[model samples]
Target: MPQATFQVDQEIYREKISTAIIRHNYPFMFVEHEGIRDLHSFLNPTVKPITRNTAKSDVLKLYKRERDKLKHVIESIPSRICLTSDLWSSIATDGYLALTAHYVDENWILQKKILSFHHMPPPHSGPILVEKRHLSLTDTLFCGGEFFHVRCGAHILNLIVQAGLKVIDEAVNKIRESVKYVRVSEGRKIKFAECIAQLSLSCSKKVCQDVPTRWNYTYLMIDGALMYRRAFDQLQLIDVHFKTCPSDDEWVKVENIAKFLKPFYDITTLFSGFHYPTANLYFHGVWKIQMLIKEEIRNSCDAISSMAKQMKEKFDKYWECYSVVLSFAIILDPRYKLQFVEFCFKKLYPATYVDRVKFIRDKLYMLFEEYMCLSSISTSNQSSVACASGGDNIGDEMDEFDIYESQHYGLTRNKSQLDLFLEEQKFDRKQDLDILTYWKANKLRYLELALMARDILSIPITTVASESAFSIGSQILNKYRSSIVPKNAEALLCTRDWLYEKGNIKFSNEDEEDEELAEDFESIITTLKNSSNDSHSSFS
Candidate 1:
């Protein structure tokens, strides 16, 4: 039997040899042994120095060729799909955004990563949103021939966050500060880690050791912090919670720190109800969030009717209970009583309530204004266009009524105008993406580009896919593996199709072959027995 080499170098070399044989069959016939040397001789008879331009050209050619294959795979996929994307900064501080394409197989099981691509990072808020918009547009353009781009729920979650960054920042900061109080010092952190470890032991899982200042399991972290009331009290009890040499005033705040964590506790409770299947509890939670918003608006509005005032307080108290859920709720439709809802919510259960209520209020006002403007425009457009020449006509009557309504409410503005004061507190909306019109426009070109490139580039549809490739690349690029040429990497990637064909090749012998081997073994056993008997006869 011929020896089979299973090492990476041999496998890579074999691929080079095979490709060369297929490309120049005549040259392969001349070689005594089919190997890398023989293939290299066919490609280049003389020893030629490799140049930077040559290397780049080779990589680009390989990339383009492999990418086209990936594109074919993506186009062949026939089903609804989802797109996943992520952004990471490399050692060079260069932004790398990866997009993944997902779809369901014919069997109705989830199939992922038919395509993927690396994108340039957005440096600032405006550019980030712009980049996000462009990606969406580009994806739609690519899939225009077939398959509407499916919205990745994860990406949608990011979009929702981008839409509400202003309000989110304050809440995020307070959460961060509270987290810092636990992590910044060794004693406090050690104690906190101990408390976490204890709980994790009880649950038989690793404890989260994420930085306190960041949003590490925002809800759960907050929940854990609140749960350890005794630990916090003990820390405060010993005055060891703060830095070793802390000011008197800082120490006092540390004592009452438990009270500051109340909002987080309230939030956790509200979010928990969603995880369960109790319908009544869910409805009650929604009512609670609604009432909180209504009540705050009443207190701020001077001309609140008795009925409105009664409804306002009803919302305020209940809204406090669900303050956490409201914090991250998507502001999809703005015209829906946001003024009263936010007013009551901020008043009742503001996270970092003291400094953030005003800020949250400002964000709500802007969202409300934008929503109302869009709704008004949509409604007006549905009606017949108002003519400039309108004398005693239907359009004229409508105009007269509108002016009269405006006059009746004039002399002073309403609750909407009062909310405008909150607007004086600047909350930048230009930061972060808002896909408010994404669905309506059906823009999915960026996703399609990613999908197409997956087949064309022979890459996956997400950062995860790229990550998988890079992991292979890393193994190949290691010191021990460094001798691997980039050409080999390209060849390995291109020949990945071989992996799919592995199941088709047979490894074990067939039934008849096994029977024949068994017969031969039996004959050998008989011969051994006869030899042993003959030796025994000679000894006798």
Candidate 2:
């Protein structure tokens, strides 16, 4: 065949090559047959010139389109949503915001979706406002859904520590000293780290002195330090700041710190025992202050009228109890105590000062009077009603592995013990909605929607909704493609998967209606069973 080959025209050869290339899905273009490697080298020699986008520009366009597609898909989702947000600061101090949306499905089942997760420019002023703005954008983009401030559960540990410090000044001081010691001296830190490493079976030197919000990371460092306390003490002797005898007033500081931290230990214990437990919701820490508020109200209710009459007599008492006055002052002023407790309390109780005072007095008095009667009752005399009564008992359900299992504070709750708590505490689930109404009235509906949203989204606060675009963006906007003018990330995120079928994402508005449907379905199934049973009996 080669010997018989005749000289073929270049045009004919190119034509044959083009046909073959089209039919065979070959990579090469016909222009390469003659070794012509022009800018149009990718196309066949016969292929006409057409206005075309560069690979980088094409990808940038697609990326932008995909983002819009996703945003559309999310916005079309009809329901209330809750968000979990966390700020990430990389080693470069680059700020990244991770926000997740949670919602419920049409069947009223919980769903979570990563709504947005990516870096936002660091806020120059108030970071919270930036967070608020981001949240507002999510709501605006996704529609008028509510947002429940589910601040990271891990943050509660620090709060618990703060609360624990209030009652246990010595322990708080010791912890503060420990924190300060590590921070103040490189020598002390090295010694402490060495000591802790020796004592801990699983200690990491790298974890020392990390921020508290890093949570488990910070805990690891402290746990290690505690494990090797003897070695740590040898490495660095803790000087006695006071010259007082070790057995006398010095011990009281230790006692006070312990007292402050006792409630925190209780919270820790409860969390450690949870089944679906998240560490450090700080519920108990918050509850302690709530209880304290109740206590103060009870103590202060000598009636303003009666107090005026006894004002002169109480002068000595005032001097003795100046700490109480200072505590009250701190509580009233938002500037003191890091602004957390007061801020949270105000948010929880959303009423004005006068209104809050009146509310606390009325609500606490009613709860106290009711609880007093129940507290006086014997376990044998108690009923399930007793277990489900008090508002305070509502918080008890937060204990891990308790209700689901047979445990209370990690121990088996014998029927007697269960009955005792049930009688004494009387926690009713239905009443929860009512109780929350007092605190959550301004925000209950909104919060409920947020809970529903979180349920339906089927994702966690850690979900990466927006970051999904980041890799694609980077791929298109590489150094080689930096000339590409890409669309904004938000627009891209908004419209991804817009036309796709999203099954049952819109949750049913009426929970009662769904319940009714379920009941009807069960009834139909029961009727069918009954009919079949009758037929079987007749045959028999």
- Number of backbone collisions per candidate, in order? 37, 51
Lowest summed lDDT window (length 10), candidate 2: 320-329
Among all windows of 10 consecutive residues in model 1, the one with the lowest summed lDDT is: 453-462
lDDT of 2 by residue, 1-540 (tens): 123234435445444443333223232323333444343333434333322232223323554556566567567664445555555543444454544455544344444444554556757344562345665766452222222233332234345343332333333244334545554554544544444545443332322342434333334334433433454354444444312112324334433333333443554434332222211123324445344433333333233223222322322232211121112222211122213333544554566545544443343234323333444464435655665665555657655446667543443354322123223433332332222122123223233322321232232222232232343333333355443332332223222212221321222222333342221212333455587799999999
Question: Which candidate comes out best when scored by lDDT?
Answer: 1
Q: Please report, in order, the local distance difference test score of every candidate based on alpha carbons.
A: 0.37, 0.36
- Looking at model 1, residue 165 earns an lDDT score of 28
For every candidate in turn, the CA RMSD to the true structure comes to: 21.1, 25.5
What stretches of model 1 exceed 4 Å from their correct place? 1-9, 12-69, 80-91, 95-97, 114-116, 119-216, 240-540
